[model samples]
Structures are given as C-alpha cells and as structure tokens.
Target chain A: MILKNKDVLGLEELSAEEILGVLEIASRFRAVFDRPVRSVPIMRGRTVVNFFHEPSTRTRISFELAEKRLSADIVNFSTATSSFSKGETLRDTAENLAAMKIDMLIIRHSSPGAAHYLAKVLECSVINAGDGAHEHPTQGLLDIMTMQQRFGDLRGKKVTIIGDIAHSRVARSNIWGLNKLGAEVTLCGPPTMVPGGLARLGVNIEFDLKKAVAGADVLNVLRIQLERHSSKSFPSNREYHRMYGITEDVVRTLKPEAIVMHPGPMNRDVEISSEVADGPRQVILDQVANGVAVRMALIYLLSGGDPGALGVGQD
Target chain B: MEWSWQRIPSEFLVTGVKLCRQGKLGKRKGFLHVRKGRIEGLGIGTPTVEGIPALDGDGLVCGPGFVDLHAHFREPGHEEKETVATGSRAAAAGGYTSVVTMPNTDPAIDNTGMIRYLIDRGKEAGLCRIHPTGAVSPGRDGQGMTEFGDMVNAGAVGFTDDGSPIASGGLMSNALKYADVLGVPIITHAEDRSIVGKGCMHSGYWSARLGMAGMARAGEDAAVFRDIELAKAAGAHLHVAHVSTKGAVEIIRRAKNEGLRVTAEATPHHFSLDHSRCRDYSPLFKVNPPLREPDDVNAVADGLADGTLDCIATDHAPHTVTEKEHQFDQAPFGVVGLETALGVGITYLVNTGVMDMGQLVQCMSETPARIFNLPGGRLEEGAEADFVLFDPACQWVVDADGFQSRSRNSAYLGETLTGRVSATFRGGRLTWRDGG
Candidate 1:
C-alpha cells in the first residue's frame, strides 16, 4: 500500500512496506524537483495551508516550496500566539480555516501531536512539519532517501546518531525511520545529551564516540540545542566537543566507505569540525536536496493519491 | 449547580445480601437493618419491620463504603473539569461513599477555609463523604510550611503537596515533622525533578521507542529512597502516592517490612496499563507517575497481593475535554477515574484472582480509612450505615459519555469491565441509586 494512513504524522507509525512505497514514489519526484521550472499539474487545484505555531524559517520554507512545486495554492496562517490565543483557541482557529475549504494542512507546532489534533478536528489531511521534540516525518523520510541512494539497501546498514538526542526531534524521527527500515542504529552521546532507555527501540546505546563510529555505515550527527538544556549541569560544550565531536581525526578512523551526515544549520567546529563537515564524503547538502522530493512524495501520497500516481499498484 | 442532600428515613432493611468485611466474607446471607444514620442490627435471615421499606440485595455484595485515599475533585478552580458535586456523583456511581479530595485544586486546599468549603459542599451535594487533604506547603510552592495543626483542627483529614512533591529536603522534613506531631500522614508524590528532567513517561525502552521524554525509574526511586530516609529521621508516617515502578515498590516493601512507618497506594491504571499503552500517544493514558513497564505492573499487583501496598486509590484526576484533546506533549496529564475505579479493580484484581473480595475491600476501605483516620470502612453495629452494593460479575463496556464525572477523559473508555456499582448508601440512606 502507498499509505493506509490519512496523515504523515510520524515515521514510527509507517511499516517497512509503506516506507519503501513512499521512498519509491519520492525517488521519481527527485527528478522532477531537479528539473528546470519544477512544477507539476497533478495537484494544481489542491489548496494547502501552513499553520506554524512556532517560529521557523527552514522547515516552513521546505514545505512551502514542495507545495508550490506540486502546483497547490498555498496559504500561510500567521497565528501570533497573543492575538489568536486571547479570544480564540487552536481548535476554533483550525475550524474557521477548515470552513474556508483548505485541502491539506502542513503544520509546524511546538506541541508534539498538533497536526494529529488538527487532523481529528479538520476534514483535510495533515502533515507534521516539526512538533516539539517529536517526530518530523519529512526529515526522517529525506534522510532515509539519502541513505538508500548511497547504500541501495538500508537493511543491516549501521547508522550511528550522535549529540543532543534528548532535545533533537530530528534524532527522534531519524531513529524511528532508520529502525523501521531494519537498520542497525546506534545512538552515541553523553548521558546528559542522550536520555536513557532509548535502547528499547532496538538501537545500540554508546557513550564513547570511538566505539560508536567503528565500522558504522552512516554517522548522523545532531546539533546541540543550547536553549533546551543547562550545558553547565548537562555537559560543557568544551567537554562535549572533546569527547564526541566529529573531528577530522575521528572521521579518519571510521570505515572507509562510511558517510557523514548532519541536519543543518550546522554548528561549525562544535558537533563537527569544518574540515569533516566540508570533507569529501559529506552528504549533508544531498539530504537537504532530497527533503523537497520526500515532501513532494508525501504531499502526493497524503492528499489521497494512490500508487496509481506512478501507474503501478504498490509493488 | 449542586444537588440537594437526600434525607435518611428512620428505619429500613436491606435483605439477602452477602456481607463482606475485613479478612473474610460472611459465611451465609444476612439481613442488614439501619435506623437513623446507623446500622441497628444484622441477622442470618430476612428481617421484618413495619413502616420501613425493604431493598432486595439479590446477587449483590454489601461491604463497607469504599474510601479513596487520593482523588482530584477540581473545585475552587478548574470547575470546567470537575466540581465537588459532580465528582461526588462519580464517587457514588463508582461504589464509593467517602473519598479524600487531594489539595491540588485551583486555590489548593492549603488552609482551613478551602478545607471547610469542600466539607460543606460535600454535605450539600449529599452524594459522597468529601474529606479534604490540606497542602503540605503554602500555595503548594514547596518552600514554606502551611498551618497543618490548624487545617487538621478545621477538619482536614491528611496533608499532601500532591501534583508535585515537596521539592525541598528541608521543607519536606519540616512538613513531615509537623504532620507527625499532628498525627496525620504526609503524602508524597515521590519524584526527583532533577533526575526526571524534561522526561514525561517511564525512562524505559518503550518510551525511547516512542520518542517521548522518558522519566527514569531512578527519578521516582531516588526520591522514594530520599523520602524514606527523611521520614525515618523525622519519625513521620510517609504515604507514597501512586506507587508505579518495581524499584520504588521494592524500597517501599523493605521500608514497611522494617517498620519505618511507610504506606503506599497503587492506582488501577498503574496496575492495569503500562508504558506500551502510550505507543499511540493518547493523552488519556498520560498520568503523573506515568504508566510504567509490564513488569512494574506485575510488581504493583504483587505489592497489593502481599500487602506491601497499603491501599487501592483512584488518583481520579479529571481534566476538561479541551485540555486533554491538545497536542500530546502540550496536553495536560490525567484521566477521569472515579466512575471506573471499582469496576477496574474488580475486573483486573478480583476477577483475575490476584486478590480476593475480602483483601480488595480491606485495601479499598479499611486500610485507607485507618491511614487517613477517617470514619466509615466498617459494617459493625452502631457504625454509620455507609456501604456499597455491587455485582462482582456484572459486565459492561466503559463509555466516557456514560460517566457521571464532568470530564470525559476516562482511560478505560471502550474497555469491558466485569464489576458494576448498583448503588451507594451513606448515613443509612440511599445517597445514590444507579438509576436515581
């Protein structure tokens, strides 16, 4: 099945078959996304709205670009917390918008299940852009697409995610996506950065960076969220960088075929040295490039499109 | 919007009921007679009385009125969620005649006036006995002590800083000492905020798999360990609220075995659900000491079975539908439990043969009443005629819409429960009959 679900809420809910189905359709969109005058007519009349409760620059733009390329009329609902929250609640605002006849809702909220909440209240499909420290499905899908491009098969692939695993929604989503694909996922960071008990997701927990990266196929590094933690009580940046930072020397010790990835905007010389981030094998830009394609695939799939979009029925 | 109290007639007879008491069930069927708010007589056969109505208790077990040690009535503030009147109806419907309303309300029952407001409102509601627990700290801020002696004098049954623990060691010790002197048990929420930092559910593998912030077992256990030490030093009775984890259970078990004056209660959801229940991210399954692992659930059942856990409480936190329908992380934590507590206990505990009816009644009634030093929880002569009538085998599907509580956030919604509360009696009168 392309997607037996109505919403692209999280990666955790997708099965291996459903994930592969979405990725296959996404690969086709990658070609369309790369071409000049990237636009499609399949969803020309579909109305999409961006409901971002939290301030965001990157994710909203990525989703907006994907929507526009799909030829959908896009409306950005700028909900200033103060004005809308004074007399109207979120459900009321969403109901008012749904009354205007929007087709799909692309929401970036500070709360974890905001899109799911709206999906219940509204009569349209919903896409979660980013919600708190919860899953960002599109980011997870793009990262998976990037991994599949290099490895051809994610099954048995060793993927190690490093740095602030506690506060990074990116890490959480990637973990779920990578696990669903049958990859050997390893989470490496200080105890302060990585909250205990994630090993239940069937991931290897590693504190020492050297042991973590040894023979790893992909090292997905995450930026430290300073606002989310007390660096002094958690771990000092100096200490964290010294222990787990992806320095050039650390990259040299990794398996020769292993690739390095970071979901930017990167903290240069902190999580990763500029040398390794700009090194020969860095696929960080490719990950961003694939994001638009994955989101395009999601928009196509979640807008009630079936596998018939590709002239095939879920192979 | 409060319901008027129903007056008790001078005399009545409840015929052919199975009498249940502490440690054992009555050998044969019995007739119970009540006159003017007191149990007048009990005999082996049906009793004949003139000018007194007789209620048939066929296929029903009559026991001491269930006493809930912990529950949130949500009055003074958050009336949209629950009020004393609606919560009392819920309690009555759940087969409870007396419930200790926690001090976590809007103004928080920190002083004498708030306590009196609940006592008076409960009296006016005429549905259940509403005993108020005073906050251990002023404003429940965990910085300074409240008037424990004055609140107790004003009819506060116990003390607690419920929603959150008394965070400071010094403040906790001081409160413990004061409550000890006043002969009231100090209830602790038992969580170390620093260790539980930013985590929501149990810091188990399932939590990591779901990507929700995991509150470590050590977070609850460490505080439990600390509070035990504090209680020992202060010579105060420490009552652990909503015991969830195995580690905490072990510590509490050892403390009780060692005679450290410790007691604990387990919520029905804690023993019934686990962290895996949050796989779908339903806020209804979200609670304070968040549902634990499967092993922890078993340990909780074992704790109750072996008497390591002192009581079975609802922790019946009611929240508005809108509050619970928000995004999972942004949503408030809790589920309406008053109307479902007994049904769930009968379904999970008694029906499963984990504990018999006598043990269940003792935990739900006698122990809680004794712990808080409240009245009721007995069916002896001259005792207040407060009791519950229920069919242990009655099966019904849980429907939130069917709840008497103001909120519709019951965790057991859509679940099939075995026991059903038929009616509740208080002060020798029918306080709440199911259809009434």
Candidate 2:
C-alpha cells in the first residue's frame, strides 16, 4: 500500500499500516546511502524548498542532503535571508513559492501548527521538519527506524522519553509514533516540564528517573531547552542533571541490550552524560544517519514514486 | 443637522411583534407607538392611531437595544482596524445601541479629551452610543492612576487597563477605591502574566497534543481571585472581562454570594467555542483568555444562566487582516464579535437549553445597562425609543466581507448561526436594517 497523505505533517495523523509502509520504504533508501554513488534520479525534475523560519543546524542540513541524494532541485530560505524579515507574511511567501510551481516544501517554523497551516494553503506536498513544540515527523520516523534496526517489531517494548516533555516537538512526535506501534511509553521529567494531561494519551508519567529508566527497551533523551526556562521550569541545569539526567549510574538500570537515542546538537552533560552519549548503548549517530534516509523516502513517496519501484536498481 | 438620520415622521406604529423586556416575552403580539423620540405607547394589541406610519414587524421579536460592557473601537490610533464610525455601524447591525469602548488604544483614552473625541465620533456616525472608558493607569502601564474623576465628568462610563492586567495588586486596589468614589466599576482584563508567559491557547489535552505553549487556567483564575479580593477590601465595584475558566466563574459566584460588589461578563466565543477551534492554528481563533475546554464553556454558560455572569459583552476586538494573517503565535489576540454576538448567543445558549431567549436579551440589554448604570434598558413610555427587531429562529451564515466593521478578522466567519437581527432603532431613528 502507498502513503495516502500528501503532507507528512505529524505521526498522529498516520495509521499503523501507513507508518509501517513509510518505514519499509525508508529501509530501501537507507541501502542507497551505502552505495559508491549515493545520488538517485527519482526526483530529477522536482524542486523542493527548505524553508526554515527557526534556526537549526542538523535538521536543515539533513533535509538538504536527502534532497541532493534524490537528485531534486533545492532552494533554501531562512528567516535571516528571506523576505519574511521585511514583513512578508507566511501566506505571501507561500503564495510566491506556489507561483514558482515548487514540488515540495520542507518547513521548520517556530509556530506549533505552521506546517499544518501551510499544508492547508499550499497545493504542493508539505513536510514538517520541526514546528515549535509540535511534531517533527521525519525525526520521529528516523528514531523509529533506529529502534526497528535494533528490535524488529516494537510491540510491547518499553520506550521511556526523558527531558523537557512540555516543550519538545521531538517527544510529541515520538510519543505518537511509538504509541501507534503498540510500544509501552513512559515520560519522565520534572512535574513542571511534563504535563500530566498527556497521561490521557495512553502514556505513563513518571517523575522518578531511576524507575523510569529501569526495564526500558529504548530511552529517547530530549534536550533540555535552557532558553525556554524564563519561567524557571527547573531550578538549574546542575539540579536537572542530578535529578533526571541519564548518567552512567542511571544507564546501568536498563537492560544490557537496551539502547539510548538523542536528537542532537547534544547539550553534553545537561540531559545526558557525555559518556553515555558516546558509548556503545547510544545510537545517536545512527538516528542522524537514518534521518536522511527517512526524509528521502518521504520526498520520494510524496512525489508519487511507487514503493515497489523503491526496490529497483539497488543491487 | 447632526441628527439628519432622525428626520423621519414624528410618530410611528410598530405592529405584530413579540415584546421582550426585563426578562419576559409578552404573551400576545404587541404594538409600540413611538412619538417624538420616546415610547409614547406600548402594549398588547393593535393601536387605534390614525394617519401614523406603521412598520410591519410580523414574526419578529422586539427587545431593548443591547448594551455592551466591553469593545475596542481602535480609533484615534489604529483606524485601519476599526474606527468609531465603522464600529458603530457594526454594533447597530448586531442590535447594539450602547457600547463601552475599552481604553487600550494607541494613545489610550487616559484623559477627558480622548473620551470626548469618541463621544463626538459616535454622534457624527449617528448609529450607536459610544461610552468610552478611561485607562486605569495613564498609559495603561499599570504604574500610576489616571484622572478617573475628571474623565468620568467628561462622560467616561468606567475605567480599565483592558489589553493587559493591572500587574500590581496595590495599584488595582487603589484604582478600585478611587473609581468607587466616582460610582463606576473598575473593569479588569484579568490574567497573570507570569503564568501566561508566551501562551497562545488553553493549557489542556489539545495543547499537550498540539505541542504549543499552553496558557493555564490558573492564570485567569488567580488574577480574578486577586482582583475580587482587592475589590472586596476597597468595598468597590469590580467587573471581570471575558470570564473563560470554570474556576474564575466559581470564584465570581462565591464573591457575589458574599455580597461583595463583583460582576462579570462572558463573551460569545467563550460560551460557544473551545480550544479545539485552534487545532488548525488559525489566528482567527486566537484570543486573550483563549477559548477554553468543554467544561469551561459549560461553566461560562451556566454562569450566565445563574446570574454569576451579569451580562454578555461582545468584547468586539478588531484587527487588520494582515495582522491576523500572521502565524497564530505571532498574530495579535482578538476576534471581531460585534456582528455575530447575538447569533452566537442564540445558537449556543438559547438553542442548547442553557438559557431562554428572554434571559438572553436581559443579559445583553438590561443587566449590562444596570451594571454600568446606563439608560435605555426598557421600553417604558416617556423613555427614548431604543430597541432591536430580530427573527429569533432565522439561520444565516457569517460572511466577513459582508461585515460593516472595517476588519475581517472574525471568529464566526463562515459559521451558520441560528438568529439574525433585522433592524435596530435608537432615539426613534432607524440605525440599521438588514440587507440594506
């Protein structure tokens, strides 16, 4: 079955079969990255724009690399260089881009529903890179891909996400994707950083770091956004690390085979210890590698490339 | 003449309408004889007057013109959004004859001259009465008090720092005490800034799921509690604007039970719409004290039914289309409500069995009038004629382009509502007629 939706806005909108369909296609794209020549002509004539309204390092470059590998024409726009700095609104910018007949727009914005808004207003396919505390579908898919590589089927697997859950788009997207895959998910953070209302979404809310880390098949550690703490969500970075950080001692609580994941630019010793972030149990780099594959698969499917054709010419 | 619109016949007979006044609809169809700009005669049955113009009001409900305790005209500064003239036309279209304009303008209405300017503009428009409220602080900075007595003498109905809360409790208490001496209520745009930092919508399941910053209900409830306490201590009248949370309603309910002079008003959006409307992240649904959950919606409706909420205020805030076109987090907070308030009230409140039609009219007209101590809440003889004729069951979809207001940023745009105002009259002159 094909991916039915035109936009990959969020995992929440995707069904289980649709998600599994994306993962299966993404694994084929992952194989292409290992070839001597990584580039493909699947999207040769397609034009995709990387519209980043928020500052980013990894997500923007990952998407650009994916577009280049797929042989798609790419134009980049950031808030600093775009007409948006001169008061041109999102609608005007979108309309202008539509006028150019671009094939897809991968948007990273600071507004939670910016991607959803563009998806409604634009005719071309829309991909959400990251929207303020909202969903990062590609990141979610890549994290899921990393997990699937370790454990074939995620059903009944314990996945604990620990960090500033209140402000993490990564956490939200992972929660939706994991929940749909039948994984038992637990969220661990300070009460201020975690909203209890999320418990209604069929996830566990645990404040204790050790209890949450124990028996977890995977731990997705989100960055503690220090800039968002003007309201004092936690006392200090030191205090947060001591209380909820995934240190060497805390990592020992997990099973010997359990993995740790991070969507980085890591905070070093903030949310995760430097040792755990670089250790064998951590697959953070693998997650990043999978991000490019996941994005390539999405752009291909949204461009109407057949999933059956994805297996062709890979030998 | 400034009153050129009033140059109709000296007397007229309104026939075959159900008259609602002081929270009751007349048992039979009635006639109202308006003479010399006053209700010369009003009762059940056909009037035996000869050679007088008769206005047919068949299948229509006539009630006192609605009085709004909160609205933002955006004149003398942001006329691109709205002016007194345009806002009056919109108000008249929505069956309102008297509106209390909020003081959060470019240069706020802090002095007597600004108040007079609004009053004169309303007179020039000749559509509705504009009662301006002076800012509680000079610039609404929440630092110092304005000249409440001087502005009140120059026709200000009340005082408020409406766009933002008075952050200091001591300042709020002092303003309440000062306004109490002038016998005017100190209206508060109740919200705690610290708790509401950068929050654009209600903090709940939708917020958690959407991943946007959520404005917790405690921000509103805490501010309402503080203001009520300050009002109680000052022994003054305090009116809460846009009561959206159930906790705030319960707080106001208890304050009234204690016989403290606390009154509150709910907006049409608060009682009808909820946070789910913000799912699309459209700036149209973004408002201060953002649309809450279903429980809060029901509580606001219940508050209006039980007199915990004293009136229905439109809170008709208008912003430019360009302004509303921004991202939801970047867009200004407001929705133009003057044209859809009555329809929303009927569709959400009356049709849901939350309150009867007469009670709705009373909340819109009489209660608001009495709360602000304004005139023209009744259709009694010798009183100047001020009333609205509406088809209570008429269904019409809201189209923003058809609005009389200058701005098109309305929350109810494209929504099919259950009631429609056909005409409005003030001082025996027709101010607005539907499809005109």
Candidate 3:
C-alpha cells in the first residue's frame, strides 16, 4: 500500500516497505535539488505552517528550504513571540493555526506525542520535526538515506551508537529505522546514560566504547546535554570524555571502511574529535543535506500523491 | 416455616443470583431478602412470592459491597474536583459500599474534626460509607504523628500519609508503632522522594523514548524494602499502598511468606495499563508510581492471584477538566477512577481468567475489609444489607458524561467494558441503580 498516513509521526510506526518507498522518492528529489533553478510548483497553491514549540536552527532551516523548493507558502511561528507566551493552551494555539486553512503543520514540540495530539485536532497533514525524547523521523530518514547512498544496501551492516543513548530521540528513531532496514545495531554508553531493556528490541547494549566500536561499520554519536543532567547523574564531564568520547584513538578500533556520524551542534572534543568529524569517513554534513530531500519527499507523499506512480522516481 | 415471597412489601428483592460470600462463590441459587435497612432473610428458589418488587439477577453476581482501601475525595479543600457527596455517589455507582478517604485533602485530614466532617457529609449524601483515613503526620508533612487515637475515636479506620510518602524512616516507625497500639493499620505511599527527583513516569524504555522524566524502580523498591525492615522491627501492621514495580512485589511477597504484618494493595490501572500507554503523553495517563511495563503489570496480576496482594483498591483520585487539560508536563498526576474500577477489574481480571468472580470480590471487598478490621463484605442475616449487584457479562461503553463523579478524568473513557454495576444497596436502601 502507498503511504496513507496523514501524519508522519515516527519511523517506528512506519513499516520497512514504507521507509524504502520514502527513501526512493527522496533519491529522485536530489536530481531536482541539483538543478540551476531548483524550484517545483507541485505544491504552489498549498500553505504549510512550521509551528515549532522548541528552538532549533538546522532542522528549521532544513524544512524551510525544502518547503520553498516545493513552492509551498511557509508560515514560521516562533514560540517565544507567539500567543503561547501569553499563557494560551497548546490546543488553543493549534486550533487557531488550523483555522488559517493551512495544508500542513510541521511541529517541533518539547513534549512527546504533541504532534500526535495536534494531528487529531487539525484537518491538515502533520509532520513531526522533533517531539520530546520521541522520534525525529525526518532526521532518522536522512541519516538512513545517507547510509543507503554509500552502501546501496544496509542489510547485515553493523551500526553502533554511542553517547547519551538514554535521552536521544535521534538514537531512538535511528534504532527503529536501522533495525527495519536489517542493520545490526549496538548501543553504547554509561550504565545510567543508556536505558535498560533495549535488548528486547534486538539491540546489543554495550557499556564499553572499545568493545562497541570494534566491529562497527557506522558510529552515530549522540551529544551530551549537560544542562539536563545534574552533577550527580552526570558525575564528571571530564570522566565521561575520557571513557566514552570519540577521538582519533578510538577511531582506530573501527573497520577501515567504517563511517562516523552525529546529529549536531556537536561539542568539539567531547563527543567527537575534529579530526574524525572533519575526516573523509565523516558523513555528518551529508546527513544535513539529505535531510532536505527526504523531508520534501515526505511532504509530497503525505499530500496524497503516489510517488511510485511518478515516472521521475522510477530509479 | 415457609415465608410468602409474593406478598412482601420490601423496597426490592434480587432473586436467582449467585453470591460471593467471604471468599467462596456460591454454587446454589439464592435470593436476597431486604427490609428496613437490613437483610431480612434469604432463601433458595423464586422466593415463593410473585407480586413483590423484584429484579431478574440471572447470570449476575451479588457480593458484599466493594470496599476501596484508598481514595482521594478532594473534599474540605479541592471541591472543584470532588466532595464527599460527589465522591460517594461515584463510589456507589462503582458498586463500592465503603471507602477510606486518604488524609491528603485540602487542609489534610489530620484531626478528629476533619474525620467528623467526612463521616457526617458522607452520611448526608445518602450513598456509601466514607471512612476518613487519618494522616500519619499531623499535617501530612512527615514531621510529627497525628492524634491517631482521637481520630480513631472520631470514626477513622486507618492512618496514612498518602500523597506525600512518609519519607523519614524514624517518623514512619513512630507512626506505625502508634497506629498499632491504637488498633489501626498504617498505610503509606512508599517511594523515597530523594531518588525519585524530577521524575514523572516509570523509568524505563518508555520514559527514555518519550523524553518524559522517570521515577526509577529503585526509588520505590528502596522505600518498600526500608519500610518492611522497619515493620519487622516495630512488629506493627504496615499496609503498603499501590505496589507497582516487580521488585516491590517480590519484597512484599517475601514479607508475607515470613508472616510479617505486611499487607499490600494494587490498583486496576497498575495491573491493566502499562507504561507504553503513556506513549501519547496525555496527562490522563500520568500518576505517581506511574504505569510500569507489561512484565510489571503481569507481576501485579501474579501478586493478586497468589494472595501476595491483599486487595485491589481504586485509589480513586479525581481532578477537574481544567486541571487535566494542560500539556503532559504542565498537568497534574491523577485521573478519576471511582466510576470505572469495578468494570475494569471484571474486564481485565475475571474475564481474562487471571481471577475468578469470587477471587475478584475478595480482593475488592473481603480482603480490604479484613485488613482494616472494618465491618461488611459479607451477606449474613444480622448484617446491614450493603451489597452490590452486578452483571459480569454486561458489555457497555464507558463515557465520562454517564458518570456520577463530579470530575471526568477517567482513563478508561470510551473503552468497552465487560461488566456493569446494576444496583447498589447501602443499609437496605437502593442508593444507586444503573439507568435509574
């Protein structure tokens, strides 16, 4: 079946076949991006609203760029300056937005299931940019797309995630997407940073970074949110860097052809050293660019268009 | 002596129903006779009288009224949510004839005056019996013990510092010792607040994934363990409230096996809904000792089935619509539970085969009554005819509008349930009847 879901909530809710379909359509969009003009009028008449309750730079730019490319009118709502700052409820704010006859709503909320709640209230298509510690599906899609572009197939590929696996919505979405794509995933972090019982999801939980990175083809490192953790839950930041930090020394443990990735705003020498992040094996920058194309594909498919029927997406 | 069944002038007679008396469900068909606020008499077969007011109790179960060991009426303070009158109506609708109101009220039920108010107000409503549970601490602040002796004399059946757990080990020991001497059990909300800091839901995959803060199992288990240790030393009766985690169950089970004076309770929400239900981040799903995983839910069911848990209490906390309408993190942590407790227990426990009808009644009524040393939970000749008649096979949808509860924060709203409380009688009078 085609993507009949009106809301693109999470990767976990999407099947492997649906994920492949989105990626295939995304690959076709890259050809459009390379054009000199890089503008499509397929959605010229439609109005899309980016209602972000959480602050973001990269993800906001990525979606704005994609919506402009699709020729859809964009409405960006800043939570800091909105009626929400005046003590209005989320439902009240969302209903006011929906009254504008917006075709789609791209929401980045601090609370989990915020988008799911909005999707039920609004008649428009809802896109979850990022929701709480829940899934960031577009980020997940782009990360997997970047991996698929290089390897062609991700079946049986070993993907290792290190750093703050307990609080990373990125890690959760990636786990769902990567596992669906037949990748063997291993999550590594401190005992308190990585959640318990992930093994039930077929994930291999490793406490030692050295052991986790040994057989890895991909290392997706998460950033440490120092503000969220106390000195007790965190203990020592320097100690965390010493044991779990990704540096040139740890890079030697990976396979020769292995890649390193991060959803950034990265801490320079903490989560990854500059050498490894700027090295030839680093695909972090590519993930940012792929983010736009995958998001454009999602908007088109969820707008009730069959990407499989599009002759341009036959590849 | 053959009595005339047809010519009696009693309010109502429930005939041809099976009853769960004490712990055993009856095999023989029996008819309950009611008159002047007491069980006049009961006999087998169609009562021999035909003209009397009667209801067809075919395929239904009659038992001593359901008793909730714990609940928050929110009265004497948060009346916007519920008062004794509204809460008792909710209780009667749920087939409960008696309930122990937790001491964490507006001013907190710490004195004999509050205890007196609750009973008088509950009686005035003409619904179920509402026993005010005295706070362990004077203000429920975990500082000093309340007048347990005076409160008991004022008609309080138990003592507890429920909403805020009595965190001080020393203070809890004192409360337990004092409650024991006063002939009342000390029920406590068990969770070490220090370890549970800034956490909202159960700490696990769901909390990690949902980005919501977590209340770790160790937070609760540590408190459960410490309390059991103290109870052993004090030799006092300790009633654990809302046992949710698996580790807590193991500790409680071991305590019971060792014959310590430990009794624990589990809620329907704990045994039926898991942490995954919080995936939507509805404040409706938020609660203290928040919903746990499936394994933990099963463990609660196992605890109940194996007699490790003494009773199934509603913990019928009510909140107003405005209070619960906020975003997940911004909203309060409780849902209206009184109206749906019986339906949920029958749907999840009895129908799922985890418990039989008799076991379900014992957990809801007999056991809680026994533990608290209260009256009722039995259908005997001289006892007041406080009974709940329910259709175990009745299938109905739960709607917040249909509830007698003042607040409509039910977690089971819109779900279809297998059982319905048909009629409830308090002191031989029909206090509540479905669709009546």
Q: For candidate 3, write residues B1-436 as lDDT tens digits.
A: 2233334344567888987777778888888877777887776666765555776778878899989999899989899889899999999999999988998987999999999999999989978888889988888888998888999999999888898888899998888888898888889799898888877899887787677778999999999999999999999999999999999999999999999999999998998999988877788888887899899999999899999999999888898776676667666788778778888888898889898888988899888988998887768777888899888889999999998989988888889988889888888777788887
Q: Could you give the DockQ of candidate 1?
A: 0.43
lDDT tens digits, residues B232-276, model 2? 999999999999999999999999999999999999999999999
State which docking tier applies to candidate 3: acceptable
Instruction: Identify the candidate with maximal DockQ.
Output: 2
Full candidate order by lDDT, most accurate first: 2, 3, 1
- Measured against the true structure, the TM-scores of the candidates, in listed sequence, are 0.93, 0.97, 0.90
Colliding pairs, model 2: none
lDDT of 1 by residue, B23-67 (tens): 566768887888888999876777756557667788888888999
Candidate 2 structure lDDT: 0.92
DockQ of 3: 0.37
Error of 1 at B66 (Å): 1.3
**lDDT (C-alpha) at residue A263 in model 1:** 84
